[model samples]
Target: MAQIGIYGLGTMGSALALNMAEHGFDVAVTNRESDWIAPFISEAGDLAARLHPYTTLAEFIAALTPPRVILFMIPSGAPMDAMIDEITPLLAPGDTVIDGGNADFHDTRRRTAQLAERDLHFVGMGVSGGESGARHGPSMMLGGSAHSWQQLKPVLTAIAARYEGAPCVAHLGPDGAGHFVKTVHNGIEYVDMQVIAEIYSLLRNGAALAPTEIGALFADWDRGPLKSYLVEITARLLSYTDPETGHPMVDVIKDAAGQKGTGRWTVIEALRMGQSASMIEAAVGARGWSSEKATRQRAETILGGAVGAFDGTPEVLAEAFLAARILAYAQGFRILASASEEYEWSLDPATIARIWRAGCIIRSALLDDIAAAFDQHLPQGQLILAPQIAQTLARCIPSLRQVVCSAMHGGHPVPALSAGLSWYDSMRLGHGSANIIQAQRDMFGHHGFERLGRSGRHHGPWWD
Candidate 1:
């Protein structure tokens, strides 16, 4: 195994460093604080003897067995830039730096080029499954050229979440692609969680069920095809107790949710790429606005409406929620696919789905369906609309349609997922869904729309 150095001996870095050593790699750990990874290494192995801790970048580089490979687990943007500036000066030609942070893709691209001048390889890696997965095995995404990737593949594969004998890891295509995919992963997670939250609210408020009973209902769902990490989380959310009152925490549960910017970046990037990514963006915004209860309540009083009333049995509501959730996934996958293509990223949709199946927040049985769907379509994302997924969507469509209608009729925000699905469902299986682009030109530029029968263009205003 190759000797390696890992910077930032925080929760993820420390655990990952030990795992690397256990996997037979001569792993050197680094942090500004020299003692950071020491305790963790001591607990896991004879780290004071086995793991070398470096206090500075120059010292770390000079000590490295050459063709130096260092894994960075630091904050993105500024701090990363500062550290790289220090290390780039010391690194020998052919050395590699792997970024395992939630960095912006464009930034990754810039960094790759900056390092290339000195023959130093840079890889933007997206490592998922948090602290625990890194210590055990986490799903990993890599992006760079074949030459650069070959150097790190062995180490990454050994420390990744795997199924059968295959590592649940892949080298995404050139420059910044891994982080791009990971950004979309987080966005999908936002929508996935939002949909689950909506389901919980609908069940608790509309169905009037207790938290434990609700947890039981979610647990039942977990046993079926909908089995997933989100479902597991649904149970946890209900089981948590109020620290103050010892009451069922669900009743007094605060509506406010927190985010750490991945979801927001996904939306902004989607807009830059001209893709429709409203559902997840709306979810992020919802979390932000949810924190302001006083504003929400006062606005509701003045506006006279907010939450909708959608009456249905638990099964009926669950089906509706599931349908909408599927649509959200549908849009998310399409956006990711488009981004991959635009970047020339040879992203294996099947591998991506499988990697997502274990460690990430969006891990769901739906991933199995997605993997199969991609295999059936190969090089196509329309599989979500294919016969099998179509059937599943059809089974849940009635409820999903009802939920959207109810939410809309009652002045609630349904956002991108349901909105996209509703729009998709409205267009019958045929070409020309209202000639929207042509209509836009007619409305704004007075560019006459062509008539079906005659070759002449119609110049009359569309509305007036």
Candidate 2:
């Protein structure tokens, strides 16, 4: 019998099954579309030796070792529910079902409880690094009980990416924690990509540089503190030329971007938790705005455009990018900390950082510093308050200010960067301008306000 079973043959599912097979774990594989099985096995090359393909669900379930470990890489919502309903009766006590998709944490939590009533285990796992990473090694975040972890640890550790000899995988918490962490990871990714795009706009429009020049600049940035998988890929993207038109590949691509709702989910959850994720919000908003390409074009024609130039050096731009990146990450971490408290999951920012340092889209050198900061136990769990991060901010904030100011003058929209700076400024203020609003609220809505010295709620003199 196969050691484990995977019930999907899409890009991710196929790659993951091959990854397990290559690692010497016989993986029984099946798919909703039975035709996909033969093509997948044929493409597995020599790895097919360890792959046992089953076309039917019953046979697939029967092929796995007793107390079967079945991983579902299908769509997260109704599809997952439907699959569970079909598979639950086939599973025995102690059998585990893993949802290896980008699922909402709330749904994961509900499913976890639902499956437990039947004496079965449910694991919501967050897998990152895309197709190539799946075939080799991806960062894996698992949320389940101790028993489920014990059953899957050996296979997961072998297939996961490693950083400094340690697997970039962990049993984060129970039920929804892993998926929640992945949602935030994607949220941060949205801001990261948006910020880079904004910088590219500044370089292309304001600086009047060619795509190859910008690509060279990004390649250089990849060798420095800004080094990350995204930056590396972006450099290659900008440098590549379209075979048809001979234009830069990025130049020929449409401006409109698409999303899969994880970023919006992150923003919604942050608002529900009463925490600010302004950078992510800005990124999501920018994506929405990008989709209305015709509207943007009409607005540009009606409103005209700014004609100023960027006076900053590449070094200054890099510094500004770094500062904005740090602020965005700080906001994401705050949301994670808030969710941990609200859910009683005790999510570790340090462990999250360490795991993200490799095999993830947002993996970067900055995560090392973030991990170190959390290791020191940041005050109030605020990443911005960490001494090392604070010092880096001190050095980079001025450059960020210069970039934002220059971009505004140049009529370039840098929403994510601007939001990051605004959040940072708001956070550093000891006193804010909200007292007048509070007094107005008391006058109009009869919502009482507390006086500076007094403890109990007090009314403002405006009512008199």
Candidate 3:
């Protein structure tokens, strides 16, 4: 009998199955439709020997050994719930069902509870690294029953991305923890992409530099402290030439940005939990606004203004970009801290940072530093407040301020950068202007405010 059964032979599922097969694990595979199996087998080549293909779900389930591990790379939300419902009756007490999808954490929690009643183990897993990562290795975040994790650990650890001989997979906490962490991972990715795009805009519009020049500059930055996959790919993207048009491929591509919902979910969760994640929120907004190309084009024709030339060097701008990037991570991890408390996940921020270092889209050299900081220090409520991180910001923030100022005068929109600065300033301010606002609130609606140096609430009589 196969050690694991992988249902749903989509791109992700097939890659995972291939990975396991290549690793000499006997894997059973099935799909919602039968036509995909032949193509999958054809792609598998010699590795197909270890793959047991099944045409039906029942057959697929039966092919696995007792106390089987059945993994689903299906659609999230209602479809995921439906799949679990369908499989519950067929699963034995010790059998485990793992959902390796971009599922909402709440749904994962509910499903974990629902499966527990049937004595079935459910793992809400967050798998990252895209298709190539799945085939080679991917970071896996597993959360649910500890017993289930113990049973599945060997198989998952063997297949997960390794950094310095350690697998990127981690058993986070219970129920929804894995998916919640993944959601934040995606949110940070959104900010990283947007900030990079904003820097590109600054270079293009303000510096009047060509894509090739910008690409070369990005390549240089990748060798420095700002090194990351996003920056690496962006350098490649900027340098890519369209064969047909003999022009830059990035220039020919559509200006409109697209989103996959996880970014929005991160912002939503942050707001509900009363944590500030302005950088991520700004990035999501930038994408939303980018989708309004028609409106922007029309407005551009009607309204135009000259912008001053860029007054900063590529190196200086790189420092500024790094500052904004750190702020974005600050916002993301802070939200996670709040959520961890609210959900009682006992999340290890350092562990989360370590897992993200290898296989996730947001993988960066900076994560190693982040992991070390979290591991060595107590919770300061914000990653930015950590001593070393604070020193880094101190070094970089002046450049960030200059970049934001230059961008404003240079007429390039750097929403994420602006948000990062705003968040930093607000966080550090000893006295904010909210007192007058509170007075106005109390005057109009009798909303009470505590007087300074006292504990009791007081209402204002503004008319008097």
Best by lDDT: 2
lDDT of each: 0.77, 0.93, 0.90
lDDT of 1 by residue, 112-162 (tens): 999998888889988888887888888787887676688787888887776
lDDT of 2 by residue, 201-249 (tens): 9999899899999999999999999999989998998988999999888
Q: For candidate 2, which ten residues in a row score worst on lDDT?
A: 304-313
- lDDT tens digits by residue: candidate 3, 67-131: 98999988998888888878887889978889899999999899888988888888899999999
Kindly report which residue pairs in candidate 1 clash with one another: none
Provide the clash count, candidate 1.
0
**All candidates' TM-scores?**
0.90, 0.99, 0.97
Report how far off residue 68 is in candidate 1 (Å): 1.8
User: What is the descending TM-score order?
Assistant: 2, 3, 1
